[model samples]
Target: MKNKPNQLKYLKYQKNRNKGFSCRRNFLIFGNYGLKSINSGFLNFKQIEAARKTLVHNLGKNNKILIRIFPDKVLTKKPLEVRMGKGKGAIHDWVAVIKPGIIIFEVKYKDYDIIKKAFFCASQKLSIKTEICYE
Candidate 1:
């Protein structure tokens, strides 16, 4: 058996060699984060409205955001299963495209919540700084 340090080195080498840019860590984190949103019931109309209000209050009255709420499958254009191999799979949640650079997301919900989740997720991921009003 290899020593602990040797094992760690071998693992790192394997990750860098094979996985390289095709890593699923980000998607995994996204999935878990999404589960938290679901368990906590964060995907609700009121929460969405609050998010919208927050964006409007902060971004001002002129900023307009295009929001699209759909299944993670639709969002990623891939399967929603993380273990599907190779493919990053769909976002499995909401998808918000803020133009330029930003993709807000949520991994659950199949209704209006998707729209809201996408906007919020994109804003957070992109660090938009300003508010994302979806009105």
Candidate 2:
């Protein structure tokens, strides 16, 4: 994928500014670190909602899964209201906080990069291992 000129410049600046900055921070996966494949809403609600349910219902072989529902878009760190769907529905880019003792699995249909960032970010913050499970 071609990089946007402005985004490229900003990334370059960040790279130069933080020489000692390590990619590991407790274990926070910054999903918005890079460009996304189209947008979250671009995908069909049915498909997205199905994926969300699969994440929660499947859970893990042993680890407990906790799904966070956001009311609106959250681009950065800030206390915000998140909405959880009743049955089968989409959680608009919801940030699922996989608590301690639970290995987080970030599931994505197409956005590998976004999933990776989220996985990494979660890993950094939660001090737990995070894995990317692509659908």
Candidate 3:
């Protein structure tokens, strides 16, 4: 599923400069195991979808997966070989401004080994480094 919001207060947003650790959503709340990010960056919808697909495919359909972050930030991109001074380009994609120590994905499962393996495969699809944390 796409992670974009249906409506927003404003369309475009400025580039994020805050790189500090996350104060909220740093701990597990919805599930027993979670995938926590170790670095700060932007997570696009495609990357999120890939990771989610991997998790679901590997973990089976019975397990429940909860995504903590949403790609609500709008990203603009100018067309290639275009001249400057045309305001901001058209909206391109949506992304989530991720901070260190923020949990990305949470899963409720019985087997620890299977959960670890699924998380490892999912982490490879993301741009940021991640570690599995458990409650």
Candidate 4:
């Protein structure tokens, strides 16, 4: 771990910012990777981090994991005891609009069985549908 990039891309750019850029990565780097995201929905930054934590724990110190998507869109939520017909809710949390084909995460490990457990734990932390895949 010599040089790790700490840059996080700006989001809240949900309005007409679709320039057809490839946010969802199709190809993978390692042989054993955890393929995720079958359905489309909002994925928060916390979810991404939690999933990565699980992957790292399972992969140990040798393997690598990549997070393919980022949460750029903002989500709103209404407070409790709020009346109806409100204009809009308050800004709650940030999220990325994940699609069906978008790959959320990819991981590589020696033990294949542990990979499944890692992905399963990660998927449980997420709010959308996800699957584990390999090379």
Which candidate leads the pack in TM-score?
3
* Per-prediction tally of clashes: 7, 19, 0, 2
Local accuracy of candidate 1 as per-residue lDDT tens digits, 1-135: 111222222221211111122122123222212211111111323334445455455444554432232211112345444465674443333322122212223232234454455445444533223232221
The candidate 4 region of ten consecutive residues with least summed lDDT is: 11-20
Against the true structure, what is each candidate's TM-score? 0.25, 0.23, 0.95, 0.69
Stronger candidate by lDDT (1 vs 4): 4
Ranking by TM-score: 3, 4, 1, 2
7-105: candidate 2 lDDT, tens digit per residue: 322221211221232222223243222211211121222333444445444333343333322222211322355555433333233222222222223
lDDT, candidate 3, equals 0.94
Task: Give the per-residue lDDT digits (tens) of candidate 3, residues 1-135.
Answer: 666899999898888595789999999998999999999998999999999999999999878999999999988999999999979889998999899999999999989999999999999999999999998
The candidate scoring highest on lDDT is 3
Give lDDT tens digits, candidate 4, residues 16-58.
4333323546556654575667776677778788877787786
Alpha carbon lDDT of residue 97, candidate 4?
68
**Model 2 lDDT on a 0 to 1 scale:** 0.31
Candidate numbers, best lDDT first, in rank order: 3, 4, 1, 2
Model 2: lDDT of residue 31: 26
